[model samples]
Target: MIHTISALVKNRPGVLAEMAGRFGSSQVNIRSISCGETENPEVSRMVISVEADDDAVTAITSDMESLDVVIQVDDLGRKEFVDRELVLAKLTMDRETTTQLMQIFEVFRAHVVGMGQETITVELSGDQERVDGFIQMVAPFGIRSLCRSGRIALKRGDD
Candidate 1:
């Protein structure tokens, strides 16, 4: 099972390292981790995905909550939340495939972010499945490079 844990911590240097250390000590395998500033400048939200069983998830969350830097910790995987990931892909482009590539991009709601002599860079933001589908669709065009932002999620309803 993959657990998505969201932690709100003080926006200070070393906080991320501290969190990752805790995970490492707990023997948890981190799948992805995304952290950024929140509406409050003093705080940052970190979304960490880990591949672990129930016991490991509990231990990881408990250890995280014990950290002084962690303001709050929530097991988002156990709640109703919305998650998204951003992907930027550079695909080989040519006159013959330009129109076809554009159609594929339109279907995935991706937009061109850059265009080189023989490459077109596109950006897409969506859930994991959507991102995977977009990559699959564009892979045939010959992907020169790709970058993906780790998953970030927020719980639903007023909390």
Candidate 2:
């Protein structure tokens, strides 16, 4: 099963590395990660996804709690949340193609961030599946480079 763990860690050198290493050593395969800065400069929020069993989840959570840098751990289990990802892509652009892509981008709420002689940079943000689907739709356009910020989630609430 997949578990999303939210960690509050002191923003000190090597802390992120330590937490990542700890999970890796425990055989937890990290699938995605995202972090949010906190009001205190010395503390930050880290959200990580790992694949493991119930026993492994408890063991890893306990070990994480013992770390000096870690101040809290919230288990974002299999439900009750809305999650999203962000993706930035540099794509080859041409006059004929750019117009078509512009229309597609509008539907996805993506923006053209830059235009070079042969390429244009586009930014898209949305749920993981939507972002992945967008990538596939634009694959024929020739992707120059891309970066993705992994799944970030918050508990769902009544409207």
Candidate 3:
């Protein structure tokens, strides 16, 4: 199962590295991770996603909570949250295919961020599944390159 773990930590140097080392020691493989400054500048919110069994998740969470820099940890896997990923794809297209590509981008709610004589670059942001679907749809067109920001999530309520 995929578990989302969010930690409130002191915004200090080496905090991320320390946390990552702890996760490594706990034998947890992180699928995705993102961190940013919170409303309190002294603190940062670190959100991590990992695929593991329940027991492993429990162990990793406990280990993370014990870190000196970590103020609190929340298990968002079972909570109501919104998750998203961003993808940038460069596709090769000719004039004839450009129109079809534009339609595909519109249908996917993606935008043409850049364009060249034989290439178009699009930026897409949505849930992982949506981004994957868009890539699959455009794969028939020659994809020159692509990059994705792994999952990032936030709780849904005022909790």
TM-score of each: 0.97, 0.89, 0.92
lDDT of 2 by residue, 1-159 (tens): 888888889888888889888889998899987777788887888888888898888898899999888998878784487778889999999988988788879989998889999898999999877999899989899999999998887667862
Best-to-worst order by lDDT is: 1, 3, 2
User: Backbone clash tally for model 1?
Assistant: 0
Query: Using lDDT as the measure, which candidate wins?
Result: 1
Q: Write the per-residue lDDT of candidate 3 for residues 9-78, one digit (tens) a residue.
A: 9999999888877778888788888888999999999888888888888887898788788999888988
Kindly give the stretch of ten consecutive residues in candidate 2 with the minimal lDDT sum: 150-159
lDDT, candidate 2, equals: 0.86
- In order, candidate lDDTs are 0.94, 0.86, 0.89
Clashing residue pairs in candidate 3 are none
Candidate 1 clashing pairs, residues 3+ apart or interchain: none
Segments in model 1 whose C-alpha atoms lie over 4 Å from true places: none
Query: In each prediction, how many residue pairs overlap at the backbone (N, C-alpha, C within less than 3 A)?
Result: 0, 0, 0
lDDT of 2 at 37: 76
Candidate 3's displacement at residue 15, Å, is 1.6
Model 3 TM-score, all chains together: 0.92
